[model samples]
Target: MGEISIKTEIPGPIARALLERKEKNVPAGPFNTVKTFAAKGEGALLTDVDGNTFIDFAGAIGTLNAGHCPPNVVKALQAQIHAYLHPCFHVMMYEPYIELAETLNRLVPGSHAKKTFFLSSGAEAVENAVKIARKFTGRKGIISFERGFHGRTYMAMSLTSKVRPYKYGFGPFAPETYKWPYPDYYRSGGLDPAELDEALLSSFETFFLNEVSPDDVAAVIMEPVQGEGGFIIPSKGFVQGVKKLCEQHGILFIADEIQTGFGRTGKMFAVEHFEVVPDIMTMSKSIAAGLPLSAVTGRAEIMDSAGIGEIGGTYGGSPLGCVAAIEVIQMIQNDGLLEQALKIGEAFQACFDVLSSRFGQIGQIRSLGAMCAIEFVQDKTGKRPNQPIVQEILRNAHQRGLVIMSAGLYGNVVRLLVPLVISDSQLDEGLGVLEDVIIQCCQNQQ
Candidate 1:
């Protein structure tokens, strides 16, 4: 079956009309990647209202690792709808909620006695994790990495590093949040990787002396792979060092796996790759196949710090989301999605590695499993970010039936989060469109 079927000029007629309606009603704050509205989504493909099908490389911003509307997830949701909708965990307990909690407790990267709780969004999970960390350690300060992004809520935003889009006017954020440098070997300015790591690690001690006392810090939250901060990946040594620093102090280590969890990195959790078990972990994005579910899994004792009524929400761990998440975990485990992620990463590297040599703008091609990105620069020597090239490439790719997105602090990175369920042929086709668009755009600049 043909994967990409572009019948109209992107928005076409029907989509343009809908776009008019959206522009009138929907506020500009909520961003849209694809100009056209989705009529249907299946596997890794999305069909627009105008009947244009796009090979989705964005995967709903890493929320569909099991693919769009996966059969198992949909089946589970259908069955759940018949049973009941919400019987919120707070009002009346549901079996699926307990089942999901048990599943996450068993699966998340820790052998210790762990507890899990649910929320409606990634921000909520992060907020609750911070609360738990503070309650458990009785500390006021929380630390996150420089390029890391947690969420948009107050506490998460305070921890988040990106200031422009996420935290521009939203001032007077949650207090006692600090930022530390995460290693970016690609941008280390000719310094050795180990040297850069040591410098960054050493800065933490300096930070404790000058900025805030380590004893006052409750937790150091990190995205195993920085998602919104351009899919930046840190070394295992760096991650271990941060964990050790947290241990040196009384601070807990919180692995923010919102974008890197559930077999996205060829592992159940990204912390597995680092060989570090976090005291607390925040998870969302792909948890329930776009069911708007997030979770905070942690050491049982730490989680128990908050009394019964202090935690949880009205819509936390809804029955449908829980059932869907259980199915998602099963699908990733049983359906070879972890290996599939590896295959996608290998294919992406093979396709982009050659381009990196051909074009001076291609600064680096990076991936940890299917989470891949190509950082563009003006030249190899200076490595000035070439954001225009990325914008052009994205524009051209969208016009040609490929849905891709950009990332990075400078917005010069083309990040690919293709669904693991994408067929080899569909993957090849999407890559072809992207490759052609890149060549055309880069060649034009050259």
Candidate 2:
């Protein structure tokens, strides 16, 4: 018997009953990856209400690098609950909040004096980072990349490049926001990789001439490895080139590490892989295990540009979130999770490399640490997005007791954000399930 144990259909009797209740009470705006309700979760395994156990690869959309219900995090949360729930940071500051800020300031790439503030979600962090950048630079125009997803809030949505579910009917977006091209090497036509980078980097100068003046731009926010944009990894030269442009034009470079931070990308942060330090950073997702906490860490002067009462929220940096985050950072350091992340990536590549040779639909196999993905296409020669095959594979994987998710602008990429603390056996079992499903689905298509 492997880690998965499916005794009932997905959304079995118990889940179906709950799903009926959820449909009546819950709004349709919110999305759910799995159709079942979680009964218990530990490490990389989650049990639904119907007694079916699944190996988790989605990791709450890249929010569980420390895994679900880590012992240290649970203990810390329990201790915090005993003392107090929410004293409310504005009413009376807490020690855990200050401790987390100090720790992030020290851990983030820069050695310069830094400050950190908290928010409730990754979107909130992006919004605040933009606010601070504009205040500090005294510019209104913000630049983001094509296919990049920052968040769903008004400003974050305005900066985002996707249009379907995220920005369909929401019109009259914030002004002074612009989009720039990001290199998608897989679809770079016939251009040399170096030529592609140079062409895109050079286009910025032209953009400033035709679109918005570089002097009027407040910042260029980027994801070192785009998460929602299909785990796209930009080359080191491209990243450095963007940073150079930001420096030359007096535009702050904000690194959106919401999905790539906290050891998800082999390094502590994906920006570290490129050897570039960001002027400001937005982080959330895995910062506090599963707690709803986000942060903006940056140079002290830049972060201080926003006057008092200009930023913050009522439930921002709740005591529980702060304590959980402090413990999560400690766990990542002490538990050898960073090295484990590299090992996970190696395991995934090993499996996918073999599968790629057997399946023609596998177009690209890419990863930066365990933030891995496999792009599916109609065929090897065509290289056209195959959303139908992806849907089939996802359905089969779910039935076989594996939880995963799809990404990319065309929704044809299968992404893996497995827990860094997942056991070797669980990791193998989960991968095996996905491989079996992919093979079965591809064979059927043939």
Best by lDDT: 2
Instruction: Kindly list the per-residue Cα lDDT of model 1 for residues 57-167, writing each as its tens digit.
Output: 999999999899999889889998998898778888988888899999999887899999999999999999999999999998999988889898898899989888999
The lDDT for every candidate, in the order shown, is 0.92, 0.95
Looking at model 1, report the run of 10 residues with the lowest lDDT sum.
Answer: 1-10
Model 2 regions more than 4 Å off: none
Model 1 global lDDT (CA atoms, 0 to 1):
0.92
Instruction: Return the TM-score for each candidate structure.
Output: 0.99, 0.99
**Model 1 regions more than 4 Å off:** none
Model 2 RMSD vs true structure: 0.7
Clashes of 2: 0
Per-residue lDDT for 318 in model 2? 94
Model 1 clash pairs are none
TM-score of 2: 0.99
